[model samples]
Target: MSNDRSKPWFAPKRYGYGAGLPITWQGWALTVGYVLIFIGVINFSEQDKPGSNFMSVVGMSVFVVATIAYILICAAKTKGGWRWRWGGKP
Candidate 1:
């Protein structure tokens, strides 16, 4: 699939068993959106008031759901099917 770059949004890691930096705008946008949502959740975690605490149940729930969605999308978009790469032996 090295030469088939038609629909790949993320590239597989060279030495690890996951995705590397995004190779497309869609992947970058997804990553950035995920990070921004996480930060937003932390910054606005207080349900009653701002700057109170980080134990908001709603925030945690949203974070968990978003994280799961992000993981699923990443796994689907990443090239090589998230293969296990022991090293650059190939």
Candidate 2:
């Protein structure tokens, strides 16, 4: 971790008060949530009329479940005492 703000995105930085990036669970949550939300929006929009296409409804439900599953997975992984590594095992 370096304090050089000019470093590239690939470089890790000590991001907090004392330097060093703080642990980021929000990132995973946001990624999963955004993806699912986008998929749901697309499916919902494509379906056009409601109560007509069962597959669309199912797909929408799956999207919601996947989003929730991602959140849970991220939460468990992040809070279970495992170290966060960038490119290799921690």
Candidate 3:
């Protein structure tokens, strides 16, 4: 916050742009896992099988909804600011 550029990237800033991501490394891991699940869902829905279109729609909807939820949770935790690390004060 004091214009100290030497701060670690994961450290929370006091003044500037506020916290970025609310979650910590664990949250990021979960996000990555979710992305993998999304990809798998899309791939399965693209197969040459019946109800592929319906599956695709459902999968996309789930992904979108989950993402929005995650963002909202992060925002709420960080008080509407970006955070580089998880937990603790923003």
lDDT of candidate 3 at residue 24, scale 0 to 100: 55
Backbone collision count in every prediction? 0, 4, 5
Ranking by TM-score: 1, 3, 2
lDDT of 1 at 77: 85
State the displacement of the C-alpha of residue 71, model 1, in Å, after optimal TM-score superposition: 0.7
Q: What are the clashing pairs of model 3?
A: 19-82, 19-83, 20-82, 20-83, 21-83
Candidate 3 off by > 4 Å:
1-23, 48-52, 79-90
Top model number, lDDT: 1
| lDDT tens per residue, model 1, 4-28 | 5458789888886878889899999
Candidates in order have lDDT scores of 0.82, 0.49, 0.57
Q: What is the TM-score of each candidate against the true structure?
A: 0.79, 0.37, 0.49
Overall local distance difference test of candidate 2: 0.49
- TM for candidate 2 is 0.37
- What TM-score quantifies how close candidate 1 is to the native fold? 0.79
Q: Residue-wise lDDT of candidate 3 within 1-90, one digit each (tens)?
A: 474333223324555654444245644665576678778777866773674577777777888887787655444445444645345455
| Residue pairs in clash, model 2 | 14-19, 14-20, 15-20, 15-21
Say which prediction, candidate 1 or candidate 2, comes out ahead on lDDT. Answer: 1
* Superior by lDDT: candidate 2 or candidate 3: 3
Off by over 4 Å in 1: 1-6, 47-55
